[model samples]
Target chain A: MTAVLALLEFAPGTGATTGFRLVDPAQPHLTVTDLAATRGDGIFETARVVDGRVQALEAHLERLAQSARMLELPAPTLPLWRDAINAVAVALAAAGVADGSIKFVLTRGIEGGQVPTGWVLGLPSPDFTRERAEGIRIVLLDRGYRHDVAHTSPWLLAGAKTLSYAVNRAVLREAARRGADDALFVSSDGYLLEGAVSSLLLRVGSRLVTPRVDIGILAGTTQADVFNWAELQGFTTGYELLTPGDLATADAAWLVSSVRHAAPVRAVDGVERPIDAELTARINAALDGRID
Target chain B: MTAVLALLEFAPGTGATTGFRLVDPAQPHLTVTDLAATRGDGIFETARVVDGRVQALEAHLERLAQSARMLELPAPTLPLWRDAINAVAVALAAAGVADGSIKFVLTRGIEGGQVPTGWVLGLPSPDFTRERAEGIRIVLLDRGYRHDVAHTSPWLLAGAKTLSYAVNRAVLREAARRGADDALFVSSDGYLLEGAVSSLLLRVGSRLVTPRVDIGILAGTTQADVFNWAELQGFTTGYELLTPGDLATADAAWLVSSVRHAAPVRAVDGVERPIDAELTARINAALDGRID
Candidate 1:
């Protein structure tokens, strides 16, 4: 028998303990008619768990609310989400998980239903230790949109971070097929966007730069936290319109996300790029110190 | 208490009659862990049922297969899909639904599961009779991609009809807010693509023109069927790159889909356009005659 991936699960409004249900990951839970299942009409957030504590819980909750608003879904209360996450976190700790990830999802509910369906699941954090230690080889894939698309086309839901991530997943698969560890999506008109599962971060001398969120990319919480700490450490932080050329010329580049925190980009499109081991360490440490 | 929308639900492989389990639409049937509800990693098809017969059933199945291939999902055999559709059709007929729609979905299944989860649902066809009679007002919205996006970027999954339709749904909602009936998506480079929920068809002079499928648009099964029949009826059909101006100058325009057949466009962006009632009737007749 295969081991279940999800160690803990919680669904609100279900007749379970504390309005959260303990679900066996092996069984079917979601009906086939859910709008989330059928139309990908939903929002989700994945936050890291460290020593039984959810990292950047407030930030994740705020982003979730923003995503829900962008999807025109009724924003779920922070308390409801907090309680559910706590419930799942408790269960994960009880299962002896010291480090893991908690994923919260709010779907448009079943088709024809008015209320949204919200749930939280806790799973073991993926082993990104190697990437963090040795860095990653990435390829720049075209995201097929100009940088100004998000500003002109709001319906594209550019930065909303909805559940329609099949494209993102596919890009990573393509990267793997091409003998790369991950993919960094560049805009059609030659601008660096973000990564499939992480945000683009570049270090050039004492300056730290990331792409502007207004250019149709998700606002990376971890990137923001690292930038705040970097600024205090005498490193100038700025948001700019970057390109593939910018990535190739940078002293170092890293993909930053909540769970992995910061994974350095050691190469681009199979070409070996510069890697600042000390800088990567400092940034990861800064992220770790700030995220609570 | 409000009534549930789905009339009949069928999930294969569950212990039930005919490998399908009857579901109560009001209750939650999906677990919190299904990838379909979480990532929207799936493909779907909606086919019309006229007098208890699924129209364009083979075409829909073929498209579903194509979409699954694009998503790198294991395609289910035709016989399996046929059995599931037959089961749902029987259930719908038993419920006295002579004219309805059947929606079949194939999700990537749970987070770590290899087998895909498939289901069929039957619902009463929406009353598009009024729209088909009086026609519909449509707004031209930017799809935020160039016409060559699909050819240049396969990761965008442009031609594949996946479950990530939130943006499409949002476009229609925006159209409704703008006092329009539907939305026709124009490419970022000023080329007519397709409709939010249907394909774009225009009657210009003696020729019938539809946007080329290479323009990051789902190849319309209904449009293909209509064009095939139109050729036999002395109408020259061609695929070309079209613009909104072309739509404004056409003698008639339509948003065609399997369930609604062909709905004539009465206006584009609040500007009234000519509607050829005779042409619409003839085209719909052709579609009805060809689709089985």
Candidate 2:
């Protein structure tokens, strides 16, 4: 098998998911009416796999459950999902892949069916060496929402890792057209938000700062891991209502995600920015060395 | 078949889509990796089918092409799509369904496969008699975007009929929780926008008004048809930047869509609003009496 796939099966009567079954990754297992395919009405999380073990498994699952709650989907069985994720990770490792990523999805299910559709896909990871080491150039794009929207308009599904990411992908393309590797979304009212697919981490001297999570941004799993690593290394970690000026004045910055670990932001909107290579390497090392 | 399904096939060598092939609607056809299933990276258009003929056929096709352009998908061969849509509509008609609706989707395709995945699904229309004559209760929800977001941030894809509609679905749930039958989205700056799955149409005396299309709202196809019918009947029509005050002030209001036709707004945000029963019936009749 080129990749590992697991379909999470739920017991209709009791509303308890039994577990997952492995499937051929190449086969089509989704119907057209599945909300995940038709309306992007679902939630998902991707975690990196290393040495046959999933990294930050609990964190990813926690975020998945948070997203489910936001989307009003059935709460996923964490222990069962944890087992399934590990199984997919182990399967990829058995296939002799050193590094892989597994993405687990929980959808609203077939339209009108009410029973949720869920899956875990495991595939060998792409070489993100260039992104992790040399760093990524980012362009700031308007997210078109206020930073406080998550509190005011929860129906907008802000801060939820839902399947409706067409805008997220579109901004990346826009960033590329503007000669950047990635895009950081700035709230409409002028606040630094988050990356299109990752979380923004800034180093301002001895303090490690991320945009306040209340500002309608995902609570980044990798960013939290880095914060834990930073704390042990005697750095102060905090979240703040950051602005573009904060990004410009910060000593260094990076976009952190589960799959990519930590990618330093070398430039913003075409201007070269400082990269904390030593701290970056240490952060990645701590993340990569995770035994969980 | 309970429903009609048609999958479009593209000629890879020539970069031309030759035609479409019928498929069993019940079978699972979409792979997990398809961008539509993962990222909601797609566009769609729903059209009403009456007596085997698609209402506002050219209008729907034009909107589909317009959405493809906004999403940067390959320009669909409209004639091929037109034929497929008509075939699906005809098949559903042949199945003894008097009033059916067709939803055509164009996705960015499977991850890394530049080819687009497209299909037309035809299903019998739901009974909207209660919604049409009795009218619907609406709640105003903040859409979390400035009215000019479409012009300011095209990446956000306001005005495009994208499949990334989790928010669209979420707001309806919010509306339901508020004991309303439907929801009308308002811009962050408090300007009235459109419905979750339909367009807002207001009757101010004899003239018809819809939210200006430039403010990141879908230009309603049925609303356009109604305008044509209105002009023929000696009523003037226009587009304007409206507000909640407008909804309260208009002589009558309706959330117009393809499948549901004209659903009069008898209430807004728990407050009873005026309903022009005579005009509402005439408009629905005009929409239903379409020859094409």
Candidate 3:
């Protein structure tokens, strides 16, 4: 079993001194009525942490705020989250977790309480060296929504990062059952949306391409950072509607995310695709940095 | 704030005596790593309790089993759930809750633990007298899926009653913002699907109609029971593809669920619709019975 290394809980108006508490990871710490647990009524973010420092802290915080807004939640400010993240990161480091993951969660609180529950959890990162070095086999699954659904249906919460990820988890399970390592969701109309847990990126000639987020996909923060860094390295980026055929014909493809960084996709639906080791290393190098 | 009236925890292998424990509602009782809270990965059922007896107990249990199977969970046996439900229902009644609700929840459990967390929660039922007697105003909202989406994609959890209810809650909030009592979801192709929290039913001339469940909507247990009763009363029930205009022109329409039973639709999108008080009374009478 993967152990929860450290945890910190924060409730609004409790103040830093009394609100945050270091809790035993093995013990139960939430009420059964919490909406997050009962109804998946919440939002969350997971980021990579190294040597007590969190990577892309500002970006993760910004996305968390945006998700809170989309859910109509009164999100705790960035500084409050910063304090909680820093506290968890320090505790994890002191517990000897060098390279790990930090999760920021904001739940709708207990049923009808009208107060939000916020917390930070730190755990040792899963070793993705095999996926990063050997690459992964992915299957194409239909997400059952048209690309234009998000634009017209805001209540569907197309792009917001909510905790209602049962579908995403189910897709991954189905992929595993089909002998695939991961799954990339295709819209009902055959347009590529995103991976279950990461964003899809492809290299077509000199330009790097990704699916447009306006089509009801969560905007990948890691993909955004990589694109910005790639642009600085003289690479152009484009957001286009991609299809499975486009992915199969691309020079290279990768699943980009905050914790896993960039994992090369060696095959799509059992058909072998090109794996660009040079491009993979370049992307990882761009993401390599220390957070203060 | 709505207070949790009663709760009972049940885990497999603990036996009936050890497994069922009446818990204080105000305390924190779940681990922070519980997948139900973190990922909304679970299944739930809410049934009405009248005069210390649960209504439609067998039907709710069957649907709960179905949902658990869909989510790949190891569901507790019907006898076990019956024991827990009976225990909680008795305690709630002892606490003077005559007309209440009993909720059965089974979560994916704590991260890496692989054990399912099952519990029964008892709360006072919200009074729906006005909505039942005076009727409710509703609006049409797009569910962002085609009617055929469920047939092709089982991983989307089309008919499974999962805990990822963020979208449902969001739609209700949007409806409140628009000054409507509730919202009924329409498919991307303009077919009426179901309500966020209930099932849609309408009467057209001598025939009663509802959207087919194959279109990725949870099959409402109450709706099914009502249909069976209506059929016994010589009302023909037809599962057909319905549009917004069909609802507007219907002789009578209703949003039915276990707790609310059958609520008449007074209007849709601010346009008045016909309501059949006689039909509504008959439907309520059909559900007026106590469980053994």
Candidate 4:
């Protein structure tokens, strides 16, 4: 079993992850010149691997398929992608990772005949000392994405995990530039959107609320899970349009995602608030994990 | 020289371009995985190569460098890129391509350390046949790009040719969907923007007009050249804001770029028009032998 475990682990120089072959560890050969890179025409997803198994694997697969459908690209066969994702998870588990992260992606294949070349990438998980339910700091930035684009903008991947993330990365960079850890995108008309890469939730006194899907916010898998768990815990939940000021005035705030789980918000626009231990307790209880 | 050219024409399997050393072209490769595939974080330019030289080489390089700067990625050293472009042109010319198109690109390098990776890519000239300047059919679509974003949107490449071209491709696809060969993006407010892949130009009687730089249009190098030559030929030239109705009503319209040179707009929204022989004559005369 130990030898088998050693075989599965992907070291820096070994070059292979799971059964899916890797070209090289340093610089693998890839058909990158295709339309995917050239045109931003693809979709991707990240999954958490724990104890040699992928968490919420079905949800990630559904999202990947849905995103491809939205992009009008052919969706990858689920069995093949599942096999690939499992292999990476098993490999990481064999390498002494009791828990880690696995990233799965389906992209439009190389630029040629018709379909896009999809890819599945896996990486090691981060080391989390403990869940910091204490909260996080957020800055609001305008992405100028129109609200009505929920159904109109053909390129509105705002609700889907499309491969065109240059702007999302830029949003985070802008937040970092302003000395904030994360950014919450506000529409040009002042309505609150989602965070740079996470879904936003605010605690207005007793009821927890987030933007509705009609507002073009991504239907976050982790956010959904947290919402369900919150309901079970007897916490009231609602979806509503919000402004940045609404978040600033909230008694509790959290950014929810697969990797981050539930990250509580401590401040907005330089205004700090007391850490809501009760809210953190509820979120962590819902996530069944610690926020790293 | 043909033998030298043979060395430059890389087989698709080889993934090597004439000027650069592409040792690997598979996944996990620094050049492929980090820069080309993952983040969609790169920039590129497409221009024509004539004889043994790249057309408007300096202008393309300027745009490439500017895009790199806007993306916060390092610009490829101009001398190295210049040498690369030249070598590729030589190879193409040697391959019997007296007139052809060339694509030059730079991307964020491979992902490592703190920042994402960057890469540079080059491809052979496209096959373009010299036509009798019969115009193309154009359709107007809203691109959701604001006018002031021409200078205001920092994360946006604006006029810079960044890798996030999904919107551009979408416009072209929309045009094709509507049975047109190309499209001219109209602002939500109905002001004519640029073409999906070319600069917009109109001939209102004797005067040749294109959108001004303030209109959030790419300041086209070929259009500038045409304007300069048109001025030399005593043809009136001006820049103005054009509406979709105005474009449809123009005496003549054309899409200008390095590759297309000066393709005429034969129709807009199914409304047919006669090609302006005088305008075509002036464009051909202006562009003749200037590229090489």
Report lDDT per candidate: 0.80, 0.92, 0.83, 0.66
Name the regions of candidate 2 deviating beyond 4 angstroms: A13-15, B13-15
**For residues A28-126, what per-residue lDDT tens digits would candidate 3 score against the true structure?**
778888889888898999998888899988888998889989999875567767877888888788878888898888887877775678778899999
lDDT of 1: 0.80
Worst 10 residues of 4 chain A by lDDT: A1-10
In candidate 1, the residue pairs with backbone N, CA or C atoms under 3 Å apart (3 or more residues apart, or in different chains) clash, namely A29-B30, A29-B31, A30-B30, A30-B31, A31-B29, A31-B30
Residue-level lDDT tens digits of model 2 in A1-292? 3689999999884446788999998988998889998899999999999989999998999999999999999999999999888899888999998899999999988887868899999988899988889999999999999998999899998999999999999999999999999999999989999898899999989999999999999999999988988998999999999999999999999999988989999999999988999889999999999977
lDDT of 4 at B291: 57
lDDT of 2 at A237: 94
CAPRI-style docking class of model 1 based on DockQ: medium
- Whichever of 3 and 4 has more DockQ, that candidate is 3
* Candidate closest to the true structure, highest DockQ: 2
Ranking by TM-score: 2, 3, 1, 4
DockQ of each: 0.59, 0.92, 0.81, 0.38
lDDT of 1 by residue, A1-292 (tens): 2112332222444412224455675565566666788889998899887766888888888998899888888766777578778777767877888778888887777676665666778888878888887999999999887888888888889888898888888898899998998999988889999998789999998999999999999999899888888898999999999988889899899999998989999889999877888878888777666537
Model 4 residue B194 lDDT? Answer: 87
Per-candidate TM equals 0.92, 0.99, 0.95, 0.86
Q: Lowest-scoring 10 consecutive residues by lDDT in candidate 3 chain B?
A: B9-18
Tell me the docking grade of candidate 4.
Answer: acceptable
The top-ranked prediction according to lDDT is 2
Off by over 4 Å in 3: A1-19, A290-292, B1-18, B290-292
